[model samples]
Target: MKELERIIHDDSNGLDYILVGEVYLPLLAVPNETREIGFYGSLHRNYLKDYKSGLYSYLSLSGKLWSYLADVNEQCVERRDYLMDQMMEQEGITEELKSRDQMEWVRRANNVRSRVDEIILNEMVYV
Candidate 1:
């Protein structure tokens, strides 16, 4: 009788298995992504799972889902910030006004954020 090796590879399935104590378990590797996904990324992830299941599966299998989501999050945050700044400037939403009328500033900023969120969802997440 021969003892089984610590690690073995199957030729037919091309999978590697490792002996853990008394059991041989398939060796699975985690995806090589370390990006911290935030709200936008989470939204995109849900959208992918719900609306684009095939694409979500492909991305997950290919180990590119995290990086892709991180990229989208970064792009959305950057675009939102840039647009917010531009809209603020155009709408005269200055710090001086904020200091003078805090309530009005809050209202305008809330409106800007709402618009940005809608645009981002339509262009990135829901698509």
Candidate 2:
């Protein structure tokens, strides 16, 4: 446990043990305890800056929801590029279908980009 603490403290891996110790573990200790929610809320209120910083760091560490969003964003970009290429090709294709497909791809790409930007903005504001 001491070694774990030392590692958690020293590692730049961005683990927030304070959240773990103050909020998560206590909740885990008594899964059915209603008081755990209040304890977590109190911890968040008392250590707002630290809690936000920890949350931002955890999100930026590239494994949780942020990572998944990033991966999906990349995929969206790739698909958009492919669609653009297809639309640009001189092969015989209906103008209507091509325009529709291009619009759809652009819309999907923009949506993913917007979501990723929102996540980043949220993290920045919280931190």
Candidate 3:
């Protein structure tokens, strides 16, 4: 009757509950994080699942895995960009080089990309 209110707040746990049928169920909803978990996030997720099971479990259980992965993805992307810019500047990989010696530019660009990828994997993604 009066005790079965439509909604309620619990001070002990600081949570809200909605009355559903004969029980009050804890209100829950998925977070509205818009960032997509890209390649780096996927790599980090796999590493955590395979090697860091305890941390993975804690993050998943606490409803923070997605947000954490998204943040990692952002950081990885920024790091990749910064590294690429530095390597490109140092190697003189430019539009002029790309237009003139296409093959050489391709080779150097590929090397830079692979190196940057390895650095990110070891420094950010895997650990």
Q: Is candidate 2 or candidate 3 better by TM-score?
A: 3
Give residue 85's error in model 3 in angstroms: 0.8
Candidate order by TM-score, highest to lowest? 3, 1, 2
Q: Give the TM-score of each candidate.
A: 0.77, 0.27, 0.79
- Per-residue lDDT value at 12 in model 3: 100
Candidate 1 accuracy as TM-score: 0.77
lDDT of 1 at 39: 86
> Model 2 segments beyond 4 Å from truth?
1-63, 90-127
Per-residue lDDT over 3-102 for candidate 1, one digit per residue giving the tens place of the 0 to 100 score: 9799999999777899999899988665778887788999999999998999999888666889999998998889889889988889999999999999
Runs of candidate 3 with Cα error greater than 4 angstroms are 1-28
lDDT of 3 at 75: 98
TM-score of 3: 0.79
**Backbone clash numbers for all candidates listed:** 0, 0, 0
Compute the lDDT of residue 1 as modeled in candidate 1: 85
Candidate number that wins on lDDT, 1 or 3: 3
lDDT at position 88, candidate 1: 88
Quote the positional error of residue 103 for candidate 1 in Å: 0.6
Instruction: Name the regions of candidate 1 deviating beyond 4 angstroms.
Output: 1-28
